[model samples]
Target: MIGQDDSRLHTAVLVGPEGERRRARKARRQAAAKVETDARRHRKVQARAKWEAEQAERRNTSYLPPAGEAGPAALRTPGRFRLPKHQDTSATLAGQYPFLAEAGLGNQGVFVGQDLYSGGSFVYDPWVLYQRGLITAPNVVLAGIVGSGKSSLAKSLYTRSLPFGRRVYVPGDPKGEHTAVAEAVGGRAIILGHGLRNRLNPLDEGHRPSAVSDAEWAMQVASRRRDLIGALAETVLDRPLSPLEHTAIDLALRDAVRSAEVPILPMVVDRILSPNTADDEDGRLAEDGRLVGHALRRLVAGDLQGLFDGPSTVRFDPSLPMVSLDLSRVAENSTLISVLMTCSSAWMESALSDPAGGQRWVIYDEAWRLMQYPALLRRMDAQWRLARHFGIANMLIFHKLSDLDNVGDAGTAMRALASSLLANAETRIVYRQEPDQLGSTALALGLTGTEQKLLPGLGTGQGLWRIKDRSFVVQHQLHPAELAAFDTTGRMTSDSHEFRNLDVRSGIPNDRRDS
Candidate 1:
């Protein structure tokens, strides 16, 4: 029996050893499979690297220097292209492309670039490089010693934007560039010529100008004008007016308008302009009164009434796609420009307040003039307040930074205001500028050395486009037709001139002429 038990134990031990050998064989097979998989992956990586090298070679072969650069291929190092640093980051990569950024091929927008020699180039990119919607509407301040293509740039942008279905409302001064674009884009161009008539009149419909009972509209207009009125009074009166004083004046004006038999603006003006019995050294007080009176009279009797009470007062239609307010004709009348800007602010406020989501853009060329009026300044403030809600993007064009110096506190307030606009913009396009203006523009736009270099040697239409957190600058080219359309002088075409005569009555008052 002992011998049999020993034999069974020996057999059990042998079987156990065999089982262990089988398990080790299975483990070895698994390890071999994993190694094979890794080898395959390595081979795939090598193939990809080889393909990439070939692509690089092809790209290098295709590289060409900027059109005018005189260089042989051997002498010139090919331009190195790398993905923008912002693209590597998680934040901007995920964020929407703002209009301030150079739009890409994926965004379905066109990036127009121009050089002094070739005129312009148009690139259609469907992708947006930066989310323009994120930026604040820029108030453009264009300044040049009269021949630097300031007006042309404005017209180019306006015309280019038309095909995209933007509504541009330009209160054109007599220069007529804005009017021409409006007509070109199938928009109604109302020249503020002699005896301009309103197609729709709230007054004749047995409705008072303010009788619509739009409390919101009244509040919006008043709110936007508040700071501006104070600023204006300070400038005109040569003394700071307290908030309480401003409120009191505002209330008095409202009460006069509400209680008056005739239009209350004229009455309010008279009251504000009435002589102050308190002091004799009140030259500023008298001037303030006159300016205020003049402004009010112009508001009451000018095309501004149409702006406030006509079809424009109705909310903008997102479906309409594009709208342009030609203020070029009204540029001469600083007060009128103020009124239109005020009306635009109020209108934009109303439009944005509507819950149906709509995106809009406001482009201002030579916007420095707009800043001269406290009302426009206040309107810009309102734009800042309602930026996100309205999805309104502003593209401001300016030739030099110093041009802003003419507004109010010279360049200081202008700089501050511009800074606010810059802070809000997600993308900034800087064209060629004088050396002195470079630092301020860079500082304001937050540009890098590459971007700064892009600015210095750029031709007329070529410039650097920078986006927040972006490392690379994009070269923009404008279309040839668009380049041809840019108006160096604010002149109207023959058709536009004939169209101006179509309206017999001038929209502007004869007494308070523009400029």
Candidate 2:
């Protein structure tokens, strides 16, 4: 009993202290819980008030629309809120216009016409562009369908440049269309044909460049003669010359050049056909050149005779404002056409090579026909590459850009040569093209879909001028006299030859001849 009583007393003492300690811990915990609840409630109330204030501020605020408030700034509309579209002049909108457009080839150069897009005057000069560093190459390629006024644009480009001290050289005018212009500009057209008495000797030492010494001139003359013979033979042969044939040609040409002061093609042909007996030790020289001789014989005795067989009847005067070789008479003969072009191009080469030969315009109308022959194409390519050095710009006018693909089979050297011509040119003028040609034209020129669509709709005298990366839709303008001179519709007139009389409203005559 005593032990149990003592244990109860110890237990009671320990239990009493433990109970107080537990109550104190519970009270501290309850206080902490209450403080935490109060802090959470305060935080929730503050957050709700802050959110309400933000909502009120947002609800009360008002701002301008995304389309903008006024003027050109009003171009944009906010949140699909619509604003009526207003039309304005491009000149006015250009202040901050939202679209891209041709800024006009600047205010310099020749005045071509008005830009149909920017509504500003469009000026273009290859030399001026090159001077401005707008183009590295001053060459131009103009393509348009027939009756699309491409010829007039070509004529205008050179004729208009006359005042700028730029002379024009039409090496071979197949249609004689430029003859009148040549004469009108105080230039001469060397007309050649079976009946007409104009002879162009390929051996004639053409315009002697100022830089060429007498000895150099002699060498140049020899080289030109050899090249002319080779080109003529190749054109006629429809293939490049063989090595043996080349050897025969070199010997024959040297002999001919040494034999005469002004060697004619007939001498070369005779020498080629029947080589010098001394060099014919093997008797196979004639056999080697038999084919080549006959091929070149065509230029002197075959279908290409009478044109380049004798000494040139007319001279190529670089001093003239323009010089054109009229080849309309023999237009029916393709071989003869190529031969004439070759001879005339060679004749122009001398003047072209002259450093003193001031800036000139070389126009190649109906470019498709001339590019057919490999020899002529090479000559043209050389000229194009040397255009800048010669102080001249070459303009190759085409019926269509697709004509380039027709040059040769794909991946062929001819095709590559043809494509390089287009590549070197930075300024490409595309006039009206048929729908069928739109895709190829676009691909060749990198035209946008909109531009490709615009091709078929372009009217006469209107063209898409792509000057580098910039573009312009130009409507070419001309004076009354220019219109009359550039008219190509005379042959397409009505069947009835009825004449319409013009009443002399002013001091004019019914027939233009009366003036």
Candidate 3:
């Protein structure tokens, strides 16, 4: 009984300390739990207040309708935007979208007219284009049917260029269309024909450049005289001269120059017909030159005698703003016209070769007629090829591009030369064409279907300009004074002269326009 009681006391003492320690740990854990619950409650209250404020702000805020803002601020309509369906060419569509059209040749050149597509002022200057690297060839090929106002456009181009210090030279004006323009521009028109007093001595020493030495001038004159006489003979004979015939003509020319102070065609012809005893050592020189001599005699004593037999009554003044050889009076005689052109060409060659002669326009007005003669065509080809070297721009006006087809047989060198003219000219202006002419014209110029179609429907003064690969539809605008001066139908329309004083811009006097 005593042992049991001792064990019970020890157990009671240990149990009492353990119960107090366990109670203290439980109290500390309960205090931490209470602190965490208070912190969580505070966070929940702050979050609820923030959410309520955001909800209040949202309830008061305004918003746009699904249709968009009303009145002037509206950017969208309630209904779908629609229009009638349309279809047209890209060329026409470009007008609707301006960015689609060409930027156009800049406004730095001469004012030509309006660009139909871009609705802007169109300007063109071959020299300006060349300097800007837009074109390598300064030559221009202009083809248009009669009554297309092409003549007026041509006149305006060169005349307007006069103020820029450029000179004009019309080598052969078959219809004398440019005569009035030449005279009006303070230039001379040498009118030559059966009855005209103006004689063109082919042997005349032409305008000598300030840069040429006396020796060089003499040599140039001799070479030109020889070439002119030969070309004239060839044009008449309608064939090239033989080698022996050339030698005979050379001997006769040398003798004539020695015997005369200023040699003429008659002197050359006389010597060719009857060779000097010393020069004709073989005694067959007269026989050799018989055909050539007679061919040339046609100029001095034959049917074509009057114009080129004696000294020139008028001289070609290169310093003039313009000079034109008016072949209108001799238009009926094709041979005579060709001969006269040959002489004029010689004069032109001398002046054109001058390095000091500023940039000039060499206008071949009736290029078709001029191209018929082999000699003239060859000379033209040479000049055209050397256009850039001589600082001259040649303008070849044709009735149609197909006129080139008649230049020679299809595959001949003559035809090739003719083709090269158009090829070398990077600027081609095509005016109104007949319906039938479309194919050949398009083929010749490599025109697009749209461009070809545009040709037949073109109105007066309107043209399709092909500058290199780019294309332009232009309406050639003319000043009132220009229209009056460039009137080619004066004889056809009697009222034209009477209405000449009227302003063409309004088709009435400026005073009457407001009335």
Candidate 4:
């Protein structure tokens, strides 16, 4: 009975409230086991996701070729890299190596200066480029505002070329900027203006080519003289000569040549005013030439007296390193300037026609002033077209490209010729320009957007050079001596003896100074 009671107590302790607690504990243990199993499954799922992420990262990574391995399959080939490396240009390589690139005009020309973009030494020689088939036309067009160092660049190009056996001929230096340069380079500058003893006889036989026959020479002389007289008359008259006026000029030129060994403008004027009895059948020859005669008389005895009234006191020798006609004195008078330039143009033909004349540089400074006259513009156009045949390079320098529109009314022959001058030149150098001129300049040069944007921000001595199909932004460097000799702003900068030597009040240069 005591054992049974103990058993019941044990049972009660185990199965009653105790037994209930024990069963609850058993259920809690079962539930705890199930929670542990669920936690393990969750950990396995997290591990699987981490493993999948690692595999995906490995698959997305770029796979470069293994060391010393060479095969198409070794690399993750991009669509752009399919072409052979040797078949592509660096311009294409920029897409690959965008940080490092260099495109330069080759290494066989003069050391011009520095290439502002590539940080390389810039070199250029037009004759060399032409021989290499890099450019078809050797002429150049340099445009810049005043005081942009365009003057110095012009001087340096030709002066540096002197050692290379090239000569420079500046047909007209309106500011007389080239006077000092010519003297420094061992060249001659003919000074012609009022009160100067120097005289230019345009009728004199110019430099004769070695290949011309007597007949050809005679024909050239007569044609040149007749054309010169007609040009002078037209320029003074401010209109083209009529057919009757042309006939009168031809008769007068012939008679003058027949009478005087060295004909003068006075002779032509007098003959035009009073023709010989034989040529004036109905006395209409004198009437036809009367207006033209008085017009040309200005050069002999009127406002343009003291120059071209007599024989040429100075001769033009083509062998000099440089030759320039200083026209600073007459720049104030448009008519006088045009007349002088017309005479100089006739003079240039003499030297330019010589076959024996070596390669030369013909520079037209202040071209805006020269292009205003139709006669001068025509002569310039002819010379520009014949640049290649004459073995010469013509450089036209003007202040602004808008000067072209100012050359003549739109669609006129002057406008066309002026526009053609720009077209013929394959080498175009643009210095800093005014904001107003940027559009026309960009259009005229076919500059890219970046290039067009580079104009206004350009610093001094920097210029954009477009040579044929290539382009370069170069910083022109000059020696101290060159800066001094090529200086055109002396009057505005520092007043020196050289500046004082010029007509100070009138702003004329020292054209006659032996400096």
Whole-model lDDT values for every prediction: 0.51, 0.89, 0.91, 0.87
Q: Assess candidate 3 and give its lDDT.
A: 0.91
Tell me the tens digit of each residue's lDDT in model 1 across 104-145: 324345445432222333333111333444323333333333
For every candidate in turn, the CA RMSD to the true structure comes to 16.8, 16.5, 14.8, 23.4
Better of 1 and 3 by lDDT: 3
User: How are the candidates ranked when ordered by TM-score, highest leading?
Assistant: 3, 2, 4, 1
Name the TM-score of candidate 4: 0.78
Number of the predicted model whose lDDT against the real structure is largest: 3
| Clash pairs (backbone) in predicted model 2 | 66-78, 67-76, 67-77, 67-78
The TM-score that candidate 2 achieves is 0.78
Q: How close is candidate 3 to the true structure, as a TM-score?
A: 0.79
How many Å off is the CA of 388 in candidate 3? 0.8
lDDT of 4 by residue, 276-319 (tens): 99999998999998999999999888988988888899888899
User: Rank by lDDT, descending?
Assistant: 3, 2, 4, 1
Candidate 2, 459-515: lDDT as tens digits:
999999988898899999988888878777766564223334444465333566466
Q: Can you tell me which runs of candidate 2 are displaced by over 4 Å?
A: 1-101, 494-515
Candidate 1 stretches greater than 4 Å from native: 1-107, 111-166, 169-175, 193-248, 256-264, 270-322, 327-336, 405-415, 471-484, 489-515
